[model samples]
Target chain A: MTFTETLQTKKFIVTAELFPPKGTNLKPLLEKAELLRGRIDGFNVTDNQRAVMRLGSLAICSILQKQGLEPIMQMTCRDRNRIALESDLLSAAALGIENILILSGDHPSQGDHKEAKVVYDLDPVQLLKTARTLETGVDLAGKKLDGSPKFCLGAVVNPMAEQLDLQLAMVEKKIEAGAQFFQTQPVFEKKLLELFLCKTKDLPVKFLIGVFLLKNSQIAMFMKEKLGINIPDEYIKRLATAASPLDEGIKIAAELISAMKPQVQGVHIMALGLEEHIPEILNKVK
Target chain B: MIITKQKELDKILEKLKNRKNIFIVGCAACATKCATGGEDQVQALSVEMSKHGLAILGSMVLDTPCDIRVVKKDLARDDKAQKAESLVLLTCGAGVQAISSVLEDKELVPALDTMFLGTIERLGNFHQFCSLCGDCIIDETGGICPVTRCAKSLVNGPCGGALKGKCEVNSENDCAWITIYDKLKKNKTGIKKYHNIKNNAAVNKPQKVKTR
Candidate 1:
């Protein structure tokens, strides 16, 4: 089934991102894919997540497709330009990869290789426009191609921006750029997400609120201090004070999903390396 | 093409004493292809000179330094002419003369040595090919010119001085004639047209300097 169709069927559509292993062995990741196959509507295959090179996202999505799972292939503008981006999209369409999540990837400095040069030929907004242009068989420069590609182009938004007006402006721009759906950054403070959702309710796009599972108090604090992700003090205290951190984190995540179910269209759970406990979290919400 | 190594810039700058106005010019056509006379390379050079306490007047890039029309237009827009006592041409010798021909009162210097036309395999990697001998022989050799392939520019067969498919003198590279022969033979073609022929040895002449 198409990703949109499946989302229409499920009231609170739950999705997750699975990064392929860096090593040649795919047995572990394949097993994880199988575990979440029926539980989640679809899974997202990240394109070089955190800038650490893994197997290509297209290949992983193809593998997931063979496993009777719908895969959302995440495409980033970090490594490729308009030409290469369009070529990969056409290949994805030919391979029956329907769902796509576009992102302006992290800088090369954040990755293992700090010396690698970055090619930001087109930003995330431009990439969304390029995807729409590909539907008409033309490139960004208006050059016609042999065939066009069909894609459910999705974009990312950081709703936790310091300025609410700036964030709302970007949302309007993404909607104008042909972004059919948006998967936002982790929303720890439900109030902040509520404000963002209210401001963007008039946008003609679907919203999937992001939920990141915290392994422990230390990791949650690290994300707060290092990544500037505003995980509330109350949530951190709840997880830190629990006897079983995983169970506490899952309980809190399930609570969040249940609360946000009425506010948004879907939930994008980024368990990070905690794929095994996703079923536990899903079981609570379902 | 304009061939330039980073080390060559140091050698030329060593001769200059005081930092006056210095204008760096780059060629857009052949020099850009070789990457030496490109705008990015010229900007890098300009920044380096600025860091070394040299007064960089300005920098510019022309489409083709050898073209008379381009030379005239570049000279007309030379606002940096008053800052520098001389101009540094980051192009082939031919291009240097072309720039000098248009600006007779200014001193022109060669920032790069004119090398034979070639293609870049990767970054910081270069390989020479065409000598531009004023003739074309790509029709007979299955589109691979033996003149550029052969170490000795032999139009016939192997030079008998090849070892392990490599030129005996230059162990770093393969014998071009052997590669050409193998390519032609694999395509089931004959080399009878490339029989013994005698012609004057091509002389390595530097591009002529013209003064208007």
Candidate 2:
């Protein structure tokens, strides 16, 4: 079944965001995919996550689809212009890959290639519209395409944005841009998620709360400080003082997933190279 | 107006290091206001060139070097200009380009680097005001430009990296979005951000203007 059908089926969907390896040694990713094949409803493959060059998401998603898995191509506008992006979209559609998650990726300065030129030819909104436009058999330049991709379009949200009103505007804009669903920035605080969900309850889009397996307080702080993702003091306190950070982190993450199960359509687990921990955390969701 | 800075004397001398007869051109409008290609600046450069042991073929501070007609007509009358082997411009990039396009045979070297369309903040300080982006959204963005000001040029809103109302890229500068929000709040216009900027064909390059 298409990912759109899965979301509309009223069943709790489980998705995982995975990064492509930097090199051709796909054994690690293949093994992770093998482990995660049936476990996840869909796999969200990253395109050069953190702007560090990797195997292209198009290639990786194709690999996953061949393995009998539904891969959501997470495309960023940082690297490609409209022509290249449209070309890739048509090719991806031709390859039988269906789902796409669009994002305005992080700046290149934050990555290893500080000198690399960042091409934000079209921002996230434009990309979302382009995805929708292609489905209508028309490209960005208004030219009719021979064939178009039927994309199950998705976008991202930052639930903890300081200017919640502006952040809501982003969500509203994405919805207007033809995003069918949204996966959000990592949510560790249950209260914050509850508040955000309350504000956005009337919106038509289905939301998947972003939850990751936090290994330690140091990792939590790193995400908070370096990544600009907010981690509330309460959760940080628990991880900081716990004797076994991994256990505490897993427990907290599992607890968050359980708390949000009723509040959200699903949860997207960013396993952080600890794919095994995701299954373990799922076991604690009850 | 376009802002410019004079190129180093040694560099200008190095280009003239090979040529003997050199003519100088300066702009009276933008370059003069910025003290880059003004008459005084051009005269100062001429004195500096003579000190370097090269023939000063005379200089003319054009009313506007970017005006091709003025550039062609003014250079046409100067006796020393007709004899000069090469021309140096203390004007902005547009001026250098205009002269280059006009002077078919003579060598062209720029004596100033055009910076940006600047607003004079004060007597000696100039700040880049506009990015020359064709689609002017300052009307919607509370007269503050995220396209030019925001380090990421995000059209939607500030990036997650912004901290304490300051930009994530340069902490010293106030976040452009924050500044806009403050302006909108102060003016009671309501804080606004454009989720979808229309296709920017106007800003697409090789843009030309012909106002009748």
Interface RMSD for candidate 2 relative to the native interface: 2.7
For model 1, residues A1-286, the per-residue Cα lDDT tens digits are 6787865564667789898889778888888887887788779999987777788999989888877899999988778766798788888988888888988666565677667666544556666777888898887667887878887878777777554553454566666767788887888887888888888888777888899888889989988865667899888898899999889999988888888888888889999978888898888973
The DockQ scores of all candidates, in the order shown, are: 0.02, 0.28
The lDDT of each candidate is 0.74, 0.82
Number of the predicted model whose TM-score against the real structure is largest: 2
Candidate 1 chain B lowest-lDDT run of ten: B192-201
- The Cα RMSD of model 2 versus the native structure comes to 3.8
Clash pairs (backbone) in predicted model 2 = none
What digit string (tens of lDDT, one per residue) describes model 1 on residues B1-212?
44554337676577444748888888888778777888988898888777778888888898888887888876546677645677877878778888777787776767787666665676557777665664566666666665666544545443333445665436677766556655666553353332322222344365355798
Model 1 pairs whose backbones collide: B21-B83, B21-B84
TM-score of each: 0.59, 0.83
lDDT of 1: 0.74
Clashes of each: 2, 0
